[model samples]
Target: MAKVDAPAVEERQKGILGWIEKTGNKLPDPVIIFAYLIGILIVVSVITDWMGVSVEHPVRVNEDGSPVVEPARMLFRSELIEHLLVRMPTIFTSFHPLGYVLVVMLGAGVAERAGLFGTAMRAAVRNAPRFLLTPAVALVAMLANLAADAAYVVLIPLAGVIYAAAGRHPIAGITAAFAGVSGGFSANLFPGQLDALLFGITEAAVGSLVTDWVMNIAGNWYFIAVMTIFYLPVIWFVTDGIIEKRLGKWTGGAVAGSSDADDDPDAPLTAGQKKGLAHAGLAVLAVVFLWLFLTVDLVELVSFGAVSVWGGNPPLLNPDPALEVTQQLIPFFTSLVAGFLILFLAAGVAYGMAAGTIKTHRDTVEMMAGGMKDMGYYLVLAFAAAYFVEMFNLSNLGIISAVNGANAIQQSGLPLPIVLGLIVLFAGVLNLFVGSASAKWAFMAPILVPMLMLLGISPEMATAAYRVGDSATNIITPLMVYFPLVLVFARRWVPDFGIGSLTAAMLPYSIWLLITGIIMTIAWVYLGLPLGPGAEVGYTLPGAN
Candidate 1:
């Protein structure tokens, strides 16, 4: 291995890529950024309170039918201190994404630790045709959200090895997988932890206007499923057409810090691992059948009386027939978080047992505990984010700002599609600064959701647009938590790979993904497509008409 000159690499970086790297490096940690924003929010709240700033509420009105006005309340008072000190624990615990992410991680961690996720990803791309390699890796990367953070650790470097085996640039392999994983973060074939996390925040934000709204973890299912489909070609085209051409070709050489025996891309799974995968597959099917049984009507036979019983309208189904079907399935929709937990836990334990990774019940418990340990930083960040969101709500600044912003946007005469597109752009720019999708949405949703609702947009649509922006720019930003890890992965093959190198390699995917995502978002709204099962593109406030 050779040592590369750092200054030379920095000097080589010029133009937009250089600027982004420089600016992104200057930003502080996201937790600290929220703390700073909280300080600024306090100052703004006091100044607005003193100025008597207020906005006419879009939905709420007085007894005489006049619009109700909301004013910014001061946050520097004693009550603020009390809420901060006394209610701190409650605020943190009640934070929407806190429980949802942690619960899903518990099961996902076990699966990853049991080697199920890694084995699945390797199996997916192991024997791909040379031409189909990019899409295979891209597709698996999108689906690899089930593995959580393990996707970054296992699939990415494995992708590089796979590509090199196929005589393609290893860095291009890393780029495609990185784009699909981080850049396609929200795009998935099925609802997973992200859906739970974001929709939980959406429920909290929309609570100001609609108190009874439930967070359906699968609210953005259809949209993100389409996103996975749309992103596949973009990643394939960029990786195969553009990036690979630029990298020229790979020369047979030893990968940095990896022996040939360890880095072999064609290594076959052991007999035990194969059996474990079969067991995991059976566990997945069993869980699915259980959920279906709970949600759908089924018939059962009673041996004693030789009679048949129809198990109709189970607990997950609504008894009333008059309501819309989506309304009837609310219980089923809300159960997806627990569904993911059960599915992963069952599959992990089954795989572990068959593969000899879990010799006893205690091993599963340790894996779950390990999952929570990884979330320590997220818990700390969530504490700050919780305070920021609650404090913004307490000062009345969130609603006031939302109402006024909605009013401005409504009066601007801009088309709804254009506004949604701008949201995609805005979120992309912000992604370069704040990388955590949940953290950024925690602060933005309270304002964006209601503001859009006032303008007749659905919370699901607002969330969808945010997802498009948040994911597209993930690969370009140095601020993304996994950006450094990705650089290290690339450097394992090409030690000269730096922040600029990775960013440059991934920029095409970023640009195309952003462009296509924005277009898709606008088109979905224009076409009036449902964002999910029962989630709509437009919303009307109850009683507003």
Candidate 2:
């Protein structure tokens, strides 16, 4: 029997992407990189301060509601030390994703540890019709963002298993799943922690200029929902049509001995697993009904004074007191991450009990604790990230960069489409350096959000563009937190599969996803689409309003 030909060495070094992985892998860890950056920011801040570099506030207002144009001062040693010594604790605690990740993980951790997520994913793909397998895996991968990190851990490897069982290339399944998981990170069917994290940064940036402007958590909801629709076919087609064809067929090797009784496609679902799945379905429905009960104001119930939680507030767009609350999404939006927490927790508890992975309430607590334990490294990363963002803000470098960047774009006299594309491209470039979405947004929003707003772009629109660039390059970048884990997943199937091989496999997906992202961005902006509920394509200065 002939051995399957390994991917060529020349292919690994074929172009810019290969060079990127090689150079990128040689860099220090993301935490160390951020620490070094913090040092550089201090020195640069002092020099820029000495040079007296400053920019007049574009729309900052004074106490009496007049437009305040005070210059933004650069950071100096005294202020830096004060921030480090006094506010360091606040800086780390206030990092937006810290609480979000922890809270959500408490539930997700239980779901994962109880074997609920693993069984659910296995059942999802194991039962998928042969004709629909590609899209099924891709769709599940996209939706798995709700589980955050678990998708990468559970789904990607499972995809490889599913494909190998079906006699398709296992790497193709891995590619498809990774594309959806990371490449399409920003695209989701609904708003969750990401919305809360990104828009909180937007709110902060907007507050820097328009103090009264309200930041809706669902500002990017409509766009992201639509993005999911647009991105699905791209991954489906790229993986099934393009990637699979290039790789020929799977003449199996390391993947041969990788069968499991738990995930075996031939084994029929037991009565208990079936019952657990039914209970899981009911749990999801219960969550849906509960949220609906909280979000909607039914006249029948309200007439009897059994008030809904959101009944007191008016519509987001129109605030006339006499008008009834037509649509209130803030309470719903704010609760989305928590809603996921509840949904997962309830479902996991139900499934765990029925399937015997969790027998008691103590088991559930242990599961949640296990989830928190898994977040140890993330907690450390968060501390470093929070300081980097807060310090950068204190240095005034973010605002200075934004002002100069906005001025440069304004002077370019280019079309808005070209300008927006450039912003996306710039963000893609930045993704190569800083891998954390929240940290990068925290640093960039002070500049990009306000800068684009001054350019007549909405803060939501700026955020949408930033997300496209941020997510598009995630698969190919070695610095992404999960990149090495993904490589390990691949090597299990092909022991000789090095970093270059994994990157080489994923490079096509990255390129096509980015191009599709750029097109989606240009179309959405040029077509003047609303980003989400109450989110517009343009902004008005509060003073002007």
Candidate 3:
């Protein structure tokens, strides 16, 4: 290694990043690109239709056993592409990224940026026993996805602080959180916009292949719940045994300088504040009790039969209980509002007692306003992202590519395991270019879901497989919208660290999980366990396949 002064090293690093930044800045975001991609897909569909390359299924098998729904020709000619493109605007815009992030996240922003998230996280870390850091972080990371950006933006930085406070390298904490947030992206009990969006595409895809194909939002909920448990130990071992000690203090990536806040010694909570918290706790329990009492299921209270957990037809997006059921405190996006309300009350009482600033509604409103103050930049980003996603999906080019490619995979007659592996790999590869899970899945589900069903795979299982690959590679993809923000965090801790270094550091996680998830999937299929309520591993039925 060349021994250069820090100044020269800094300048050289800047030059490299400056170049990369310039190139990246010129690149359209995934939303815009997806729009263009959707357009291309539309063009192909038109071409294929004009060329008469599509297959038509009669009520009976016409000539070949090759089902019209699963025909290989979907990808072959250009017209199928046009059909894909034309239909994209409706689908993509509905799941538009701007709308995608904002609807659920407004309350998230309120809860987090208002200092509730930060204070709570710091408190948890500060109070956590040493043995609990790894699992705690892993759990928080997965749950943080509930707030989407809050998890990445707030939790990642806090991880560094938490790790450093524990006498470990801050980077390790950051990495663990990053792994949880990005790597565990698909594993959540509650449905978010992403879950709803992906389910729609998978449903469309599966329906195209089967006469009775359906997909629900809780498709992977049970398996992911298991994964949360499975991964907690893995993260705990890796962090405590490998990451912490290897993460020596104040190294290249550990936080230095004045910016590090976790270094501050914890101030004692006031006796009054503690008392206030007792009040808040009782209030929260009361609210929860009332909520539970109101929502007692018909199956429990009467003989009206089971309540529709999925909320009805189109089970994945609908709250219809007919399809699937999994645990969640509130309905997907709406829960954010409910959560923030509780947090606001809880935190407000604590703050009031400690600071002696509040006794009325005015004070509470001010606290909320403070939260809103922190949200300016994100709202702009959200609006821009929304427009970008909407436009890109209109393009349809990406859709054609996914549809065509998936068609090829279906006809290959590869063993189920092999096909799953290939899909995982394919997902990883595509991730290099695309970062939005729903957008990519929107492109893929219509093609892959149906094909998998033809081969006796369930839509739920296929969605889970796709989730694994999509999530595993998130850490490695520079194209991810938040990738730059993460680099900024890394550089805070390791000022000398470059973008490449951060990516390289994260690669171990991405690679390891990719392999682990594949093995898990094979095992899951072998067990023939329902992926979730109404979700199965094997073929639909003897006659169906």
**Top-lDDT candidate index:** 1
Candidate 1 lDDT by residue in tens digits, 10-58: 5346887677777878988889988999999999998999999987766
What RMSD does each model have against the real structure? 2.7, 4.0, 7.6
**Which regions of candidate 1 deviate over 4 angstroms?**
1-12, 61-67, 253-257, 260-262, 300-312
Considering summed lDDT, which 10 consecutive residues are worst modelled in model 2?
313-322
* TM-score, one value per model: 0.95, 0.88, 0.69
Cα lDDT, model 2, residue 92: 81
Could you give candidate 3's per-residue lDDT for residues 332-433 as a string of tens digits? 323333443554455545545443545665666665666556646544433333333333233332233345554676677666877777787788767766
Ranking by TM-score: 1, 2, 3
The lDDT of each candidate is 0.87, 0.77, 0.59
The prediction achieving the highest TM-score against the true structure is: 1
Residue pairs whose backbone atoms clash in candidate 1: none
Q: Model 3 Cα displacement at 102 (Å)?
A: 5.7
Stretches off by above 4 angstroms in model 3 are 1-27, 58-103, 106-109, 189-193, 204-215, 240-255, 259-265, 268-411, 538-545
lDDT tens digits, residues 157-182, model 2?
A: 87887787788888888888999989
